[model samples]
Target chain A: MTFEKWMRESLDRVETALEHFLPGTDIAPAKLHDAMRYAALGGGKRVRPLLCHAAGELTGASAHAVETASAALEMIHVYSLVHDDMPAMDDDALRRGKPTVHVQYDEATALLVGDALQSQAFIALTTAGNGLNDAQQAALVRELALASGSIGMAGGQAIDLESVGRKLSRPELETMHRKKTGALLRASVRMGALAGATPDAAALKALDDYSAAVGLAFQVVDDILDVIADSATLGKTAGKDAKDDKPTYVSIIGLDASRELAAQLSRDAHAALEPFGARAQRLAELADLVVNRVH
Target chain B: MTFEKWMRESLDRVETALEHFLPGTDIAPAKLHDAMRYAALGGGKRVRPLLCHAAGELTGASAHAVETASAALEMIHVYSLVHDDMPAMDDDALRRGKPTVHVQYDEATALLVGDALQSQAFIALTTAGNGLNDAQQAALVRELALASGSIGMAGGQAIDLESVGRKLSRPELETMHRKKTGALLRASVRMGALAGATPDAAALKALDDYSAAVGLAFQVVDDILDVIADSATLGKTAGKDAKDDKPTYVSIIGLDASRELAAQLSRDAHAALEPFGARAQRLAELADLVVNRVH
Candidate 1:
């Protein structure tokens, strides 16, 4: 399939899978369920799931396990966004071109929604045994937990909150983004690869390198878009970093230098995939998509 | 061993195990780490861990696996309390006789702390294979997720929130409490039972009965205490449930009937344990403690 066709199909699959895994609104606690579905089902680039499928294909992993794991990753991502937008955190009023969960629901419901979504993600992940034995399932859960836990996304968020209104050096800024966004992206690649019957260590290492590079590149692009794109295009507030007094690549290293950094990371990502040769074409295409997207 | 000595020692063991499992203050993003430690290590009854340990002992489960699983359950419990005590939720200022997490730290920190604690819990539980094989570990994760997810504790809390300032029938109140408190308590017992090398279906069912009864008994006693106890004894804001117009067993069925219900549940808990005979001596004592504790 063409890369565009492949990407479109993967996004559709992930959206459908997420809908299947999420509790129905008709169930009890309909309000919280509605809020969770509202936050998770909103249209956004299913970038993590796309990365997962690309890596899974290279490793000859079962498509079913990869899809389930991808949905699981998206749930964690959605939960983070829901919690991050709460009044106690970023206090944002909007997300994905609509009202944030806390704004649409009460702050208390938003909190529970985040909690429940995170719980459901773990539940979804345990079903990855289609091509995997029990050990692989445990490994997948452990890796996702590591990526989502204190030293990963949550810790990075803490650093972001602490650094607001303060000048941070380029290295410090990269460190924050690496944890906040990069960790889950990296896990997405690794998790899909893990479902394969045999995951070659060298190939896994190469994929790790590719994931790290793409993760950083994605953040660099996000920083760029926050500066150049309007909210209508970005689906979130434009220039939110500056308004929140949060440091970003554009603020710390200049937009020109930031673009150069993204290009360099993209090149690194491409180089890391040489181990897979033709098998990694989709991943290379994905790297291009991340670095080149306007929004 | 005397039940008192066993109870005291298990509490001590769990406290130390939790300390070992929690991230040290030296970790980067020390503030979030510190807040997690503060919320988790701060003293409480350690009832869930005690329940987990008692259940784990029945089938010759590994001590290491039991301790790790116990810590994981406690982490989830602590995370729930941290989030539930936030200004947006219960708006409580005190817990365990001290300032709540959101009060001791900023709201953002409290939010991150809860998020991190939950992530760490999943990570901790995956270590169940120290005695359990990979399959058992997977089962443990699935069970805990079911207990913690939207249809469980979070769902129950949603019901509680909606029922505030409004009357709920006895059955409605029971359903809410079953999800809120009973689910986790039952999960505590179920997970520990699962740790055993050979868990028979009949024994598991009986334990489930025992867990359900004790779970409701715990909450019924809690509701009774809320009405009659003082804050100094409860280590929380006693009478706050009625003050907030929240429905409870006492509120729905009256205080005297609530006490009778607790006693009946305790008897049922003991009867369910007849299958284990003398092996469930500790659980029997735990049932007595739950129904009889002053606070």
Candidate 2:
């Protein structure tokens, strides 16, 4: 299948798997469930889960195993988006072309929805029962925790808030993105590989290198698109970073250099997957997709 | 040792275990860690950990098996407190005779502190090396997730918020409390048993019964204290529930009957442990303490 086709298929499987785990929407306090579904199942690239599935495929893991990891990663992503859009954070009124949780519901409901989604991510992992052993499950949970906690996304968010309107070095920006964005992306690939129960140290290391490269490349492309695209095409406020006075790679390195850097990182990401031969094609395609996408 | 003395000793062990797991306050973004420490280590009854230890003792589980579960439960309790004190929630300015998290810091910091603490609680469970097999660890994570998630503490909080100033029946009050307060308390005992690998079907059923009875009795006593105690004695805003027009067991059952019900439930809790003989003395004593304490 083509890269886009494979991604669509993988995301479909993930959505189905997640639907099975989510509480039925018919329960009391139906609005909370509605808010959760609105935030989680709404549109996105499904990039994190796609990376997981591709990494797992490269490592010879089964489709089901990769799908479970993908579902878990997506849940974490959804949770972060819900909280990041809250009034205390970015306070954005929209996400993925739709009203954000707080705008669609009240702020209190939005907060609780975020809290529920975060807890539900771990619930999905622990209950995945997709042939992963307990050790694999525990490892996945641990990796995701580190990716989501203060030292990772939360800490990165604090730094981003602190750095608003302030000048930052390239190294400082990279550090912030690495924690805020790269940690979970790296964990996605690692989780997929771990779920296969191969436990190959060298293979895991290579995947980490590949994930780091693509993760940064993904953000660079996002920065480029924020400048080059519009809301109609990007499905959200495109110039939001500039409007918020947040620094971006395109702003720091110049658009031409940023584009060059993205291409270089994509090549590096592809190179890291070469050891897996044809099984790694999806990962290579994903790397290319990360740097080449307009939105 | 008497139950009170045993609880004090067990709580000390739990504190030491928590300190070892938590990052030192000197970590980057020192305020986050400091906030965590300030909220987590502040004085409380340590009732949840005591339940964990008592359950393990009843099941012939060693102290080592229960220590991590104890700490994890306490972390969840601390996280809930942090969030509950947020401006959008109870809007409480104080807790346990000290300024609440938002009052001490800012609303944003308090929100993130709660977020970090919740994430840290699961991190503790995942990384906890208590000799539990992979399945057991997965089960423990799952149990804790359910107890703390929308269907448990978060859900309970939502319902509690909605039910304020509204008359709720005895069963409705019980259901709300079961999820809000009882779920975690019951999970504490169940987790301790699971950590010990002693959660056989019969013992699990017995513990569930014991947990349910004691959980309600605990709430009953809390209600009584709200009416009879002052803020200086309770360390929180006593009578605030009535001040806010929140429903309670005392409101539904009357204070005299509520006390009678608490004593009866405590007896039932103690009786549930008869099968374990003197090994469950700590748990029985805890039931008494729950209903008899001033705070």
Candidate 3:
């Protein structure tokens, strides 16, 4: 299939799966469920789900397994964003061209929404008939928890909060982004691969390498976009990182070098999938998309 | 063993397991880790863990399995408390006779701490060497997720938030407490039973009955203590429920009826354990303790 067709189909699958997995708004505590659906349903690029599906193709995972894994991955991503936009965190008002959960619902509802979403992510994974065996289900749950917990996304966020108005070395910034975003991105690939057949050590390593490169490339492009894109284009506030005095690649190493780094990382991601040959076509395409997408 | 000695030993076991399962404070984003530790350690009755251990006895589960499950359950309980005590929620400054997480660290750190602790709860279940098979592990994860998610603890919390200053019927109050706190308490018994040998349907039903009664009794006693105890004795602010105009058994049914309800629930809990004979000794004691404890 063409890349555009594949991306569209994958997004459709993820959206449908998320709808099925999430509690209905008519459920009790309807307001919290409403906010959760609002935050998770229509938003952002769904890049993590795309990566999960793409990586699953190489590992011969069933479509059902990949679909379920991707939905769970996306839920975690969306929950993080909901929490990040809260007043206690980034204090943002806009996300995905709409008011953030905290602004749309009250802060208390938003907190419950984020908390519930995180729990739902695990529920999605452990729900029976997801095409994963018991071991795979347990492994995926562990992978997600570790990737999003103190040593990963949340820890990275804590670092970001502490780094405001302070200078961070390039290495420090990279480390933060690796934990903040790269951890979950890498887990998407790993989980997809694990969903069907277990990948051998070399295969796992290759996929990890591809994910690490693409993940970093994705962040670099985000930094570049923050400087060049408008709020309308980005679907959220633009240039806020620099305005907040938070260090970014463009701020620390200049815009030109950051773009070059993104290009290099994209190339690295493609090279890492070389062993898989034509079977990795989708993964290669996704790497390019991460690097070259306008927003 | 005497109930006191058993309770003491179980508390020690849970504390050590939690210490091992939680990330070290020296880890990156040290402040968040510190806050997580502060919220999770050194306080509360550890009632959920005690219930887990007691239930595990009836099913012949390994000590290691029960211990790990208890830690995960306690982590979930503690995270809920951390989030519940936030300014946006209860606006409480004290917990466990010390400053709450948001007060001890910053609001951002406390939020991250709660998020990380939730993740860590799942990690504790899926971690290797936890004496559970993959199927058992997956089952436990599902139990925790379902009990804590939108339709469970978080959902109950949302209802509580919306019901402030409103009159709720007795059944409405019962339903709220069942979800907010009862779900996890029941999960504690179920998970402990599953962690060892899968209980037969009859045994599962009996355990559920026992847990349900005790869980309600626990909440009723909490309301009683809120009215009668001081902050020094309760390790938290007293009478805040009535002061905040939140519905409670004491406010709705009056103190005499509430105490009678708790006593009846305690009797029901003991009756549910008759099927297990002497095997349910700890569970019976726990039921009495839940209904009768002063603080």
Best model per lDDT: 3
Chain A (candidate 2) TM-score to true chain A: 0.96
Interface DockQ per candidate: 0.85, 0.66, 0.94
Give residue B220's lDDT in candidate 1 (0 to 100).
Answer: 88
* Error of model 2, residue B98, in angstroms: 1.9
CAPRI quality level assigned to candidate 1 from its DockQ score: high
Per-residue lDDT tens digits of candidate 2, residues A161-236? 7788999899999999998899899998898888775757888888999999998998889999999999978877
Kindly list the per-residue Cα lDDT of model 1 for residues A201-286, writing each as its tens digit: 89889999999999999998999999999999888889898888888988889999999999999999999999789999989999
lDDT of each structure?
A: 0.88, 0.83, 0.93
Better of 1 and 2 by DockQ: 1
Question: What tens-digit string does per-residue lDDT give for candidate 3 at B50-101?
Answer: 9999989988999999999999999999999989999999999999899998
Docking class of 2: medium
Q: What is the lDDT ranking, best to worst?
A: 3, 1, 2
Candidate 2: segments with Cα more than 4 A from true spot: none
Judged by DockQ, which candidate is best? 3
Q: Model 3, stretches more than 4 Å misplaced?
A: none
Give the alpha carbon lDDT tens digit for every residue of B10-114 in model 2: 989989877866667777556777777888884788889989888887766667667877887888888889888887778888788899888997776777777
Report the CAPRI category for model 3. high
TM-score, model 3, chain B versus true chain B: 0.99
Per-model TM-score on C-alpha atoms: 0.98, 0.96, 0.99
Worst-scoring 10-residue span by lDDT in model 3 chain B? B25-34
